[model samples]
Target: MIRIAVIGQSGSIPEEVERMAEEAGAEVARRGAVLLTGGGSGVMEHASKGAKEAGGLVIGILAGDRTDVANDYLDVPITTGLGFDFRSLILVHSCDALIMIRGGNGTLGELSAAYMNCKPTVAIETSGGWAEKVKQTAFEGCYLDERRTVEIHYAHSGKLAVDRAFELLASKWNEERNTGVTGD
Candidate 1:
């Protein structure tokens, strides 16, 4: 299954942002994709909740060994015990694409990781925080830096964000297949 990870802030968030996260998760499920997250609070919790409500599988890449800290909606918790920064890499590396919501430094790090790995990313601009800031500050409103390793896509709504991610994944898959890479 296509695995999509939603990365965002872990603390309290505005109600609308929560709703956006939920919609993104639900859209991921409706598209028959597995949802992955940092598995903490705030955006992670809300996304997991939405995925669960939609009967989607949720995987939480947790930083600590204690699954108790993971959100209640997780179908499986991969307790990495790798701490925040390292676990963030695991989250990025494990997913086919990433959906970014309102976030802080942690989210920025994840975005950087995605770029470095050439992983497809969709940022929900209307959710505010880095999701919004990244669009304005991105190089030519696309690449993060001069390297232009991978361009990040922006979406104004949750469903659109997920839709964009799927489109990106499909294109990437097609490109790999055309090149006879198999993408395994």
Candidate 2:
């Protein structure tokens, strides 16, 4: 199954953004994909709630070696003792794609990691924070750098973002298959 990580802000966020995150998670679940998150509050919690409600598997790549700080919606909490930054990298590396909602510095770092790892990512453009800002700040409004390893797609809604992410994954897989280059 494809694992799609929802990268976004933690703690106090706009209601609209929370809705978007939840919708994205629900969409991911409905599509039979596992939902991954940082397992904290705000976007992560909201998304996890949606996924759980939709009967989807929710995994949290949590910081530290305890699940006390993780959201209540997680089905599996991976307590990584590697701290926040390292745990974020684990979240990025473990996913096939990512959906970005309203995010701050942590989300931005995840975006950068996704780009570096050539993972497909779709950002909700209207969700604010890095999700909105990166569209203007990124090179050619998509790539993170001159390398252009992967194009960051922007969507107006959570469902659209998840759809776009699946499309991107399909395209990438097709391209790899056509080129006879297994992305192993």
How does model 2 score by TM-score? Answer: 0.98
Give model 1's TM-score versus the native structure. 0.98
Candidate 1: residue 154 Cα off by (Å): 0.4
What is candidate 1's lDDT per residue for 68-102, written digit by digit as tens?
99989999999999999999999999999999999
Q: Positional deviation of 101 in candidate 2, in angstroms?
A: 0.6
lDDT scores in order: 0.94, 0.94
- The parts of candidate 2 lying over 4 Å away from their true place are none
Question: What lDDT tens digits, residue by residue, belong to model 2 across residues 83-105?
Answer: 99999999999999999998999
Best by TM-score: 2
